[model samples]
Target: MNARKTWTRTLGTATAAGALAWAVVAAGQPSAAPTSEPVAETGPGYAIEDYNYPGADRILAEQGIVLKRGDGHIVLADCLSEENLLRFLARGRADVCFKVTADEGFLTLEIPSVHGVRTDDSVNTHLAMTAEDDRVEYDIPAKTWEGVGESVDGREHVLVEIRVTK
Candidate 1:
């Protein structure tokens, strides 16, 4: 009977020790329950557009011209700002001028009722104009003035755009 009681007590003690060691290990481990929502899968994103010209709207509103996008080579110039510039003569409007800042530049603008353009000698220039049913192009000689629109032909033309290479 003494041996039997000692064996039962030893078995109980061993079982208790095993259970305590398991509890200690479980407490040290991270919880199985999630603490935050799983992140959602996303698709490919899109690219942004950045092709607008700065101050183009104001120029259009104030000058009655639509100055569109360009490569930052040609810009509007105050007629009195400089002695040498590409000048244009418009019907019933003051002359307009553009200053070339780089060795090569291109501009897209609509100047209505343009009759003539004066070119600067420093840069080779080209002008495009539109009439009722025709598109006209003119190669402006360096440092010289050229006639366009009604001045050249009976048809009145609107100056559409200009390109300059220095």
Candidate 2:
């Protein structure tokens, strides 16, 4: 079971975007809300969906990707897996980081933790990007990031898909 869990999380940062397109898998979850909001900006883009946090809190926490600034610490999971992450991006300015482990002994795979760039508007109602360049500042709205994964029991699976809008 350890191998399975490892591979699952591994697909997170790597293939964070590309692989998600080709496969249909159920992701884990995220972390809980801050009970409030962070009061500083560091990375570039970030915010907090306070009201909705409790609903999807488990998903983010399980993902385990946290960032901090001063007396404030915000998890990237706190922003992702939502309809509107722009608020968090604008406020948190989080530098996205992700990690997903896999059972290396079972499968051999090549997934990018930082998949190039693509126009992903499949999730109707969410125009993640109006264009493909400088996602922050809402200029080009090009999103970029990466993921990590591994092979296990002869099957390739996903761990996480870390995406940053910048």
Candidate 1 local distance difference test against the native: 0.84
The model with the greatest TM-score is: 1
Listed per candidate, the RMSD to the true structure in angstroms reads 8.4, 35.2
> Residue 92 of candidate 1: its Cα lDDT?
86
Query: lDDT score of model 2?
Result: 0.28
Candidate 1: worst 10 consecutive residues by lDDT? 37-46
Q: Show pairs that collide, candidate 1.
A: 121-143
Q: Model 1: residues >4 Å from true position, as ranges? A: 1-51
Candidate 1: residue 35 lDDT (0-100): 62
Compared with the true structure, model 1 gives a TM-score of 0.69
- lDDT per model vs. reference: 0.84, 0.28
Model 2 agreement with the true structure over 15-46: per-residue lDDT tens digits: 77767754544343454646754555445566
